[model samples]
Structure formats: structure tokens, C-alpha cells
Target: MDTDIFSLRGRNIVVTGAAEGLGRTFALAFARRGAFVACVDIDPAVEETCALIEKNGGKALPLMADVSNEAAVTTMAAQLEASADTLHVLVNNAGIAIPPGRLLDVSVANWDRVIATNLRSVFLCSKALLPMLLRSKDASIINLSSFLALVGLYPGFEITAIPYASSKAGVDGFTRQLAIEYARDGLRVNAIAPGWHGGTRLGRERQASSEPAVIKRFNDFIQGSIPMGHMGTPDDLTGLAVYLASSASRYVTGQTFAHDGGLTAA
Candidate 1:
């Protein structure tokens, strides 16, 4: 009956990896809708995110911490809680993709690094902030997974992506389990499985090792593979993120909404 169900007014929201790319976009989006955002990241660039929010007349806090580290995550939660009484939304979007390589050559340490950042950070952030989330009338946890989590990336892509894929798939599992566990407490957990976006470095750090020609050709192949016949933009996800975080999705839980321009669908 209340039109505000779709609005995030007066909410306290945390967004990990809020330095740049999709995370920054999400923080700005939430803040624009009246959510007080905590922009957390290991990089100082998160200060830019906070500044942008404040410039737009929205509330924001810039928190610097490594989401993968238990102590750092705990401190981030404590610091955020010291100022905000209750946390209403958490967007776990911090992640990395190691260079593509077969498992035969992938070291155990490399695997741990990927898993720790992509998966463990989700667990640590959620664990540390759940108490604050529990105190809210409506709370939401949105995990950032990938289309690779739903399916192996065609074929060759899988060789260099096992570690990343494994980590994201683990996120899907964690989301479902946690959602079920806390659904009764008015907490909803869900995942956003994004397809490749044009400007977000979606994994461009690894792609940078390739020749420009190779990159262009690879991009053509990827775009052709997507049912939409084009790449996605970072803003494409903001609507979905807002929906899930607001009371609009209160009845939704344990679901992974893919925003891949129909790549996973095809």
C-alpha cells in the first residue's frame, strides 16, 4: 500500500569495492534514492565515491579496508556501526579475476587468493555485519556473482577461469544457504550474476596481456555470442541492485538474477 516500498529512503547501505566500476555506480545509485551509503574499499579511490555522493546531496562514508581480511572486515563493520545504528543493505561486490590459465599450471596459492577475495570476503562481510542488518525492519544482502558461476564460459575460457568460476559458484551456494537461514528474520539474500560489461574491467586486467588485435577479435566473438548482440553497461545493473535492496524485493530470496544481456540465456 505504501509507495515507498520501492524507495531506499533513510536506509543504511554498505557497498564493498566501492572505489570504481560497478561498485561505485551502485553506491551512487543507492544514495540518490536516499540510502546513506558506506563506501568501503582497500583503495583510496573510494574517497571519490564518497565525494560524488555528498556532491549529489546524499549521505556517504568512505571506509578503507580489505574485505578479504577477517580483522579488516570486522573493523569496517564496527566503524560503520559506530555511526549508523542499523544497516539495511549490503552489496558484496569486491572481487578479482586472475589471468586465465589451466589448473595444471595454477598454483595453490593463486587459487587461495582468488577464492579469498571472490568468496571469503562475502562470508566475512556478511558475518561481521549481520547483527546490524538484523536490527533493521528490512534488510538485504546482495552478492556479486558472475555468469561464469551459472555455466562454464563456453570452453577455452574455462581453462583460465576455474579459480574465478569456482569462487563465484561458491557465492551462489552461500547466498542460498544464508537467505534460507535468515529469511525468517526479515533478511533477504540474493546474488547478481552479471555478464561482461563494456567499461567495467569485467576482467580487462587479464585481457590487457593480450594484443589489441586479439582483444578486438575476442570482443567481437563475445558480443556475437550474446543474444542481445551487444555488450552491457555498468548502469544496466543499477536498476536491479536498487530493486533487490529496497522493499520491492522483500518477497524474493535465494535467487540469482543474471544481468548479462542474455548471454546466460543463450
Candidate 2:
């Protein structure tokens, strides 16, 4: 059991949506493992994430850009290329879920916005960064997906947005196709489909917009559905992320792993 296989020493990595939540967690985890992390986000708060990494004796760079915007992504790629000769890993963790509602009740503008932010951003970032990624001996692209992509919620729950679910499904398809296309080049593409995680902005936004009774019902239903009987935290996904970014999973590619509290199984 040589644990050295899990080391990410000297590797260069990029994590989008790193201003907060799971993206911040992934950036910190990689930096702690001795990887040089570039924390990218549209929010200026991304500097805070980099500050924390530096506080802990880790190397980090904060880059501001809207990943959903092609021009912005192109600029970000250029900045990254100037900073590093090659990129070892890319965590496509930037995504947004609009307010939860039924399909017909949702507006067309919101639907398109979700798609652009969640699905299109993955494409833009990967395409812009392909050259840098290809230069690495071992490159991996880790896309953040959600369990909602695989199954629909109970009717009238309004616990999940239609556009959000659809965008994540697209991410899965993109991951599989890209994985096959780049396998010959030794670039692995994979997705992590998280379920019912607490302490994220998504959960908070949903709660803030719902009535007390609706919130209670949503919470009760979620708790009852998960076999583990509890929601996960951002920390729960860190280990899986590290595994995917490290050589420990060099042979793995084009797979979507559910980090649900056994919700997907039950």
C-alpha cells in the first residue's frame, strides 16, 4: 500500500467556481496535496480562497472570469498559459441552479441562463484549455454534475429546477464523449454527481425562496429518501476529488460517480 500514488506534488490545477462551496473545497484540497492551484471565479471573493491556500503554505493564483462567457474563458486560458507551461488537472466545478420551479412555470430566459452557465461553461473551458492540458503527461478533467441529472424529483416538490437537471444531463453526455475522444491522448474526463448536500448556496437559495411548510416538507422528504438518513457536506466529496485528480485513478475515465448519501442506491 504505497500512498505515494496519491501525491499531486508539483502538478498544476485549475478549479472554477472556487469563490465558495465545493469549488473552494476542491481548490484547497489540491493545494494541500502540493499542487499549484489556480482558483477561477467570476466573483472577486476568489481572492479569499487563494489567500486561505497561501495562509496554509500552499501556492495559489486567483483568476477572475465568467466561465460561461466564451471571450472571458479565452482570456482566462491565455492568462493561465502564460503562468504555466502545462495544466495537469482541470475541475469544471462552476455551475448555477435557478430558483426551483415546475417546467412550464419556468421562464425561457432562466432556462437558457442555466444551460449557458452549467453546460456551456464546461465546453468553453475545456476547449480553451485543451492545448495546455495536452502538454501534461497525465491530464484529467473533472466535471461537477448532480444526481438530479439521473432521476426526477417527486411531482410538486419543486425541489429541483428543470433547467438545472437538464444541464447536468448534458454534462454527463459531454463527459463520456470527450473521454473517448481524448483517451488516445492520455486525457481522462469524468464527472461527479453529487446528491443532497447541505451547506451549499443552492440549498440556501431554495430554502430562502420557499415557505416554511414547503421547506419542512422538502427537508423531511430528502432525509427520508437517503438511506444514510443524513445529508453530506462539502468535505465528503474532497476524498473522491483527490482520487480523481491523482495518479491513483490514472486508469479511470469517462465515469460519473454519485456522492449521494446512498440516495441513488435506495
The TM-scores, one per candidate, come to 0.96, 0.97
State the TM-score for model 2.
Answer: 0.97
Q: Model 1 — which ten-residue stretch has the worst lDDT?
A: 152-161
Candidate 2, clashing residue pairs?
none
- Angstrom error of the Cα, residue 225, model 1: value is 0.6
**For residues 1-266, could you state the per-residue lDDT of candidate 2 as single tens digits?**
34698888988999999999899989999999999999999999999999999999999999999999999999999999889989999999999998777888899999999999999999999999999999996899999999998888864567777999999999999999999999989799999999988887677777788899998888888778899998999999999999999999999999999999888787
Model number with the top lDDT: 2
lDDT accuracy of residue 198 in candidate 2: 84
Q: How does residue 157 of candidate 1 score in lDDT?
A: 48
Q: lDDT per model, in order? A: 0.90, 0.93
lDDT of 1 by residue, 39-113 (tens): 999999999999999999999999999999999998999899899979999999999887767777688999999
Structure candidate 1, residue pairs in collision = 100-160, 101-160
